[model samples]
Target: MSRTSVPPRRARTALLAAGALVLAGLGAVSVMQSPASAAGLQCSVGYSVNDWGGGFTANVSVTNAGTTAIDGWALTYAYSGNQTLTSGWSANWTQSGKNVTVTNLDWNKTLAPGGSTSFGGNFNYSGTNTAPTAFAVNGTPCNGGTSTGSPTPTPTDSTSPSPSPSTSTPPATGDLVDNPYVGAGVYVDPEWSAKAAAEPSGTKISNQPTAVWLDRIAAINGANGSMGLRAHLDEAVKQAAGKPLVVQLVIYDLPGRDCSALASNGELGPTDIDRYEHEYIDPIATILSDPAYKDLRIVNTIEPDSLPNLVTNVSPRPTATPACDVMKANGNYVTGVGYALAHLGGVGNVYNYLDAGHHGWIGWDDNFAPTAQLMHQAATTSGATVDDVQGVIANTANYGATTEPYFTIDDTVNGTSVRQSKWVDWNRYVDEQTYAQAFRTAMVTAGFNSSVGALIDTSRNGWGGANRPTGPAAKTTLDGYVDGSRTDRRFHLGNWCNQSGAGIGERPKAAPAVGIDAYVWVKPPGQSDGASSAIANDEGKGFDRMCDPTYTGNVRNGNSMSGALPNAPLAGHWFSAQFQELLKNAYPAL
Candidate 1:
């Protein structure tokens, strides 16, 4: 990536607008380099670059050489050549002319003596790429040294989290707990935080933890240049800092993935089951099982929009797609997801939460029971069982509100049921929380353990702003009542792209309600669902009409306006305007 290159985007990462939970691993490259720093706030910085002619990827490993624990540090270096930064991970990256600033993320900020943490970035240049002559940490000039027998650099997940531990959270050791996040620090992605902090009001929510989407195989290793599955996990352990830490990884990328949509299409073909299992899921599972991460609580959001598509996007349904039909006939989604669940679930520290469709997609009577059955089928097949699954996640990367304060499905106006309203559209549920709770109950009935939990993705569903409804909509008409009383502002319930006026939903919290393990921002705000129009790229993503604001109705959206914002980038790429709007309208306002 060059200085002028756009940032990588993957908000819901692999949910909705296109992909869901994916994982990858970036192999380390050994390079000859001099390290710096020996005491005080000093650090030894190792810079390793993987160049490809016009562009190059660089890894910077910072080893704390100080006697006392070096907590909260910033690394700085000057590029000897014209190296423009495009994107980065493992830390926050920023450049001003030739100088680059790398700040430790919440996870990597604390470096005990003799310990090392790493971050990397992508750069573009025309001439020779010369490594910087000097580097510094926390304003102290770094001295030359090499990572050697450092006891503190790579500590287990038992390390205390940096920047002050919260007194409210219960402390934890290296074992499983009822709710991993109950007294733990969730990972704040340095990559996404860098993007957020770049915005005018980005700092408001930049540090909030969001799921790191490893959508494609390439992403598993590194997207934009740094942070593969191993890199992310390694950072998570560091962030754990002797306390329980939760690292959310989206386990997306099934063969013939997202059959019902084009924007988040994956690299695997419809029948690439073997590749999905061996190359993708198996490798991720192996990485997660690495003994180093045994102390971290790893939460994997199983394939989203996969099983539900099998339930609702197949034959007989007017919303069905030929691709969906092919997917169903092939039976890959079920197998792939089942295999993923089986393998990842084997990891000691991993907790698996399958993705259930949002309230709008599977809340209907005809779709509910069947979808739950489909989920049950997956959970029990391919060596997986109910015990392998901790729970299910709902409305992932979707704009479904957690709740509707003004009305219920049972409410009536002039003898017309709320389900009769255009917005409710015959669906049995009014909002995500109700849908999730009922779905949880149905899951138990469908054979999941009674203790199974549910996760609600509250990112971008708040719909708060001046336009937010003050109370139930006018009951003069059923349609008006449903429309006015709702918190979700989408033109249609099926609108899943970069919807206009969408705002950040509930800030993530654990055990927010009964049966609900957490309210999460699985879909990080400010990332585009898909391209606004057809654009070409190698990322395997296609342009779906749903992402084009000007495109007219799709069966999924009830033929309404697409409800997307304009000029969106491909799915997972940063959407500046959308981020700005998210801040402008954040609920419990920023």
Candidate 2:
């Protein structure tokens, strides 16, 4: 999402005779083209690095200016003579000294008529502008020159754009960095709670949830603090190479909570709420309420699906009138939660997105509208004129699961999954575009506008939404089921949670839509839902290794029943991993 808005690359002032693509004006053959001909294809290759883990990623676009589609082509270029390809994809290559020959694979082959192809790779560096020489296509020289040897496009010694501060840098006010737990909102057990408490704290204000949780976050720059959640997350992200990861977390315990049925700290409801208010929530409110905390960006959920489930269950009670009808009664619950934070005085510090269950999870009419109204009423109850919450988030933890994907136009699920007769009223999963449109439309109808919006979990959507077909092979590749008999070889590393197969383009456009506030990752990747390998089915230890490493795109140690951070399962320790994954997903170009 951090894209550079600089002007497009211009033709190198100094052109080379060799790397130049000469259009013969002949049939089909436009001429010999060079990699430099493509936008962003720097005549010289080097990155403006911000830190060890973050830097500019090189995108080498090789357009087949030639009329015919080339089945396969190779890119041969020299780095600054010191830079190395950290990792690459879409093509393969062998490096010999300064000359690296990159060959396109079957999937990357075939440049269509008047069509162009682009292949990119990244390198790990920590400084600025180091140019290389002699780029070629399949051994043919490129740059701004001809096939015969010529001086490569000479890069001007002019200053290149400076890189932004690395996320490794400590959190400062007004920073809009991604929360590692960006997309995580799901059911987490008490074990995580116990583990989180037991984990050592690096900050003096350990009582403060923000301080305690983010103590290790700053260490992402390198090893800046005691090894805690961030360390494990860093390891997992590194293991993922450069792929984007989405981690999900469900904060079930709110203490003094009404939805205790869905979750309990195992502590008394009122007493637990006491601890949460003073020890956890209050302290978090204090820090985040500060202008400093507001400067720092992270996704914070006021509560999970408790409100929706409560309304769905209690709204029908004979005594209940239209829930959000008046702030005096039904709105009190939501306002009470908002009041505690509003009292903290950190407006806009946290992105408070309430829960809007998946289309399959709740109804659009009574359920969705009433919930949104409660948010408005809660703001009124607190005597706060501004909307306290951002927007409603749907599909909290249910990514990759076929049971539910996005909001439905019609109430097909009707708050239950048991009926086998329910058919999807419409089929929109044609592409990412369609999927995104459905999500936007559904939320808009549900009253999510510029001031409010939704967040989708992209993790586990890499394969089609539904579980892969039955059989061994089905269970072994990117599409294989997580619990199927097939070995763990099915999931994709970067896109495991992104159901791009739904044929929907990116949803909730980068900019906020009218009435839609911010659509961000509410669920980050890597946290487990208590299924350890030691448990019943393979589902047990599901938290074990992020998917079996035997699987194609695995990220962590599958053998360790213990989750990624601070060794074995720690209550809130998984949050650390989720946070770190969100950072990687958000700042991949870094």
Using lDDT, give the best candidate's number.
1
* Model number with the top TM-score: 1
Q: How many residue pairs of model 2 clash at the backbone?
A: 79
lDDT of 1 by residue, 332-373 (tens): 888887888766776666788999989999999988988889
What are the RMSDs of all candidates, in order?
13.6, 22.9
Q: Which stretches of candidate 1 lie over 4 Å from their true place?
A: 1-175
Please, what is the TM-score per model? 0.72, 0.37
Worst 10 residues of 1 by lDDT: 12-21
Give candidate 2 misplaced runs (Cα > 4 Å): 1-252, 256-276, 290-294, 315-335, 344-348, 364-366, 383-386, 400-450, 461-521, 531-590
- Model 1, residue 327: C-alpha shift (Å): 1.3
Query: Candidate 1, after superposition: displacement of residue 160 in Å?
Result: 41
Q: Candidate 2, 78: how far from true, in Å?
A: 71
What does candidate 1 score on TM? 0.72
